[model samples]
Target: MMNNGADLEQCKRLIETSLGWGDAATWTNEDFDTLSDRIFEKTSVRLSISTLKRIWGKVRYDSSPTTATLNALARYAGFEGWRDFMATTQPPAKPSPAHEAPPAPQKSPTRRFITPLIIITITFAVLISFISARIIHPPAANLPLRFDHRATSDELPNSVVFDYDATPMHPKTVMIQQAWDPKRREKVDPYGKQHTSIYYYPGYFRSKLIVDGELKMQSDVFIPTKGWKAIIIGDPLPIYLSAAETTLDSGRLSINAATLQAKTGSPVFNSKWTGFFDVHQFAGISGDHFLLRTTVRNTSTVEQCLCRNVSITVMGKLSAIIFPLTDRGCISDIGLYTGFTGVSGKDHDLSAFGCDFSQWQQIVCAQKDQTLDMWLNGRLIYTKPGNRSIGDIVGIRIGFEGTGEIKEATLQGGGVPQDLLKQP
Candidate 1:
């Protein structure tokens, strides 16, 4: 029951294990709050958010231990000390019909094996072999959790997952997909109600339908983690809307798990995401391709984060904010502007027919601060009123390299697919 090294290790281990980490590495109080929130979802522990954060602060650069902190965890774990606690690998059992009554227990001589543990004053100079070990090799219990994992692009034969960047999906009886764009959020009440004002702007070029001439715009795709992966679309729009899945408008793009790992902090070139996916020919673009150019947001928060063991659920309503592209693609490497950059070109090359060359109004969003210049054969045809935006673009492809980072994506209508982000 008294303070000891073993108890400290166990407390550290508890936190680490709860967060799916092998050891209790240095963490600020806020980090612990986030960690506990993640763990509490899967368990029925009545933990106050504030209390866990305080406990985290105790181990985070705490050179001195307080009596109150130790007593709290000891009581919560229903244990006398750290050593006695770490010994419980599984959760204790509950009432069962098989055991109508309990049997008497007896003690053995093995109890003498217990050893006294040492507790050193908090000091950077103290040996931290355990801490180092955790960072180097975390225990198996600490690995992150997953719902599912679909391996190959070929898995979506009959029904599709709407995962990668290709489409014309083999007509499936049913399909599921996951979609969580920050922009797609909406406000709802417990009884199921929503209230919001999220609008998508029109840019200059829609899909191949609006772009007139034969185009092969290359794209720069950014991967959150590097690995070989691909994206695919699953909606039966070709049948329902009688439109090509891809156009100058939107489509899907898939990346590899290996590709994700390799492009850490960088982006890759994906031709499929450059413009629209021709639903008619999309199925034939590539063997198991991945990429989708739907109404997706491409941006990230400037504030860096320190979150782990996190999951979000929306049993009620949600809300989101969307920034449409107007002026230019990007103001800088990370800033935002309307897609309005001016580059001199060889003038209009509108040879292909079914064209409306007179006006090139906004094809994307048309918010108030900026306007974008539509270019064909390098020449500007239409200049929509641009409203400066704060996020990147789902970008239109020209010769210059491009990249995409979804800032906000949401469902406008229809029963949104459920497998949009299911881990495969």
Candidate 2:
């Protein structure tokens, strides 16, 4: 059996491979942040960016990760837990042959000594040659780089065609990252002029070009939905809802519990979520300074979904603003995320976001200059400073643990008003 250290290392490697994000050495701070978010989304366990960085050796920490952390990592990798992962990773013992071959003769002491000496000399020579070659030919620098993209369509599952010029850095592999998540990165031929990547969801994305492990250039790739789209979040792929499957009437948009159960093929809504997305380019709404007002409530009456959680997300070009709400007693499980920072209820007092979801509740989020404020039921509950600029607001998403309804939604900025329920 492998030691604890070896097993941990193996687990890290498997996570990296499953993520498909190039190499961990080339990952940036934002990559780690994205990793933490993805892990929470899949496991409902939050691992801070600092913790993730330490696990990947990006930070200096003397102690090993806690058991809870290891279990979370294993679950993110599709295992039952750390113990289950270890059981599967252990190598099976090999059986000995019934009739073993007789031993040959032993080598002389002088031959053994000579053999080792010769091998050492050859290894030393090869190491010297490799070092000398690297010194003689260093990587090229300051080449004129160009990266840009064009979306093939204005809908989900849209493929974007990228036009790049990296011929000056030939022989070096180039990477095109679809968004902030490094897992979306893909290698392209250095000599090729174009590359294509498909986006499974609609949102504002920043595409980047990397060469020699350095960022060369980046461009914006915006894929807008044709209209409001409903979906049930699923593993590997989400179950999309047709327009006929949703109810958009009487100035509200909603999905019933039966529809969610039918789409997910599950009776219990423990972690199942249903979302409505209105993704498009909001011309005058800047993510840094805007007001998003919406009336929402959880409609799940299932016994298993006691938390009755719901979240509102404003998708931006650089990052997003996610505000969550839950039943008063389940406040510890909610979290708030601004583009640049995040706060969890487990560590902070987020009781203001807790309320009764049996009736409609109005939530308002406003960002001005460097401050962000949140209000529930027309009462200001949370205020935070140091809000970073996240570029233009491109889309909005509302998610519920099981089922929910949006009575009315509006986004206002730059002296313009947008009705989120109405199509452009």
Candidate 3:
């Protein structure tokens, strides 16, 4: 019989193969970061980069992964959970006939089996006791669990106040998670009635109330941007920019490196990013059938930013459609999300999304009949087939590695054009 350690190793190997990113032994820190994002995207559970490194043996650690982490990994590997994966996994093959060992003389069965029998009896008795206890004291039928949230304002750096009541469950611990990322979770007093969390960015967030690791209730918390907001993406908080700070004239929206440096007080732009967001509900626009046309270009030179990457995101109620454009050499560092699933450039041929950033590039994304088609410079680059509708089109976000410009951004469906750049 294979041990739990061997099963875990097999699970890791399967995940690596599914990722199709070559070998885990050669993966870098950035690779692990990307993996972390992908796992969260798929499993809705965020695993810290350090925790992943330890699991992959990239970091030196003695403790094994927790059950929750194993469950997330199993789910990412297309299984229900760790238990399901173990149940369905096949054991190693027996030795071949030529290598088989000779049988030893059989002895009469004796007290040697008594210890195992006693252990089994004890386990059975414990299970029965647990079942009896559960039957005798069942959970509250009408517990009246309530969870809801309201945003304090309509802009970035917004605070959301959550009202919940998990008292009936009598859980030892209560946690309020801002969104899908568990890193945003915070412990709350079970007896308390309110908790507040600040959202530094605008998006459609699903706030959850968890009682003892079990999700008791959840609600949608949509924090829409006032209009076209520019910001330097930062940790814990972002540097917000006013219309005067970002250049929004002559049918163009952009922020230069100087503006970024002034706002962030930093000159280096290796991993820094700037984003333009219009995160409000677009009336009568369905995410399943819409057209987004934009002209974008990276303004930074190679010396300022090596990758010169740009990403366009169409935020939907359920999921978002995200695609990236980068310099030809940095294509391997990008990924695409088609509202249903995400694919990395490392395993897939995403060369079509790569282009020369010295000139303006036209990008068109259209979703119709549950299928998404991407066009670059009038050339079809990718076609993704989706099953379910991603609900209404909520917002649009344009991001740049260092500095970039959007000449035009328009979304249309049923032949009606909605200028995303217009002030609300």
lDDT per prediction?
0.28, 0.82, 0.84
lDDT of 1 at 195: 21
Tens-digit lDDT track of model 1 for 210-274: 01111112121121211112222112211111123222243333222233323333333322122
Q: How far is candidate 2 from the true structure (C-alpha RMSD, Å)?
A: 11.0
lDDT tens readout by residue for model 3, 285-317: 988788889999999888888998999999988
lDDT of 1 at 331: 17
Runs of candidate 3 with Cα error greater than 4 angstroms are 1-139, 414-424
TM-score of 1: 0.19
* Top lDDT prediction, candidate number: 3
lDDT of 2 by residue, 192-277 (tens): 99999988777788788977555678898887787788878877788888887776668478888788877777767878888889
* Shift in Å, residue 64, candidate 2: 11
- Give the TM-score of each candidate: 0.19, 0.65, 0.70
Regions of model 2 farther than 4 Å from truth = 1-143, 302-304, 414-424
Candidate 3 clash pair list: none
Instruction: Give lDDT: candidate 3, residue 34.
Output: 73
Predictions: Cα RMSD each = 23.7, 11.0, 10.4
The candidate maximizing TM-score is 3
Number of backbone clashes in candidate 2: 0
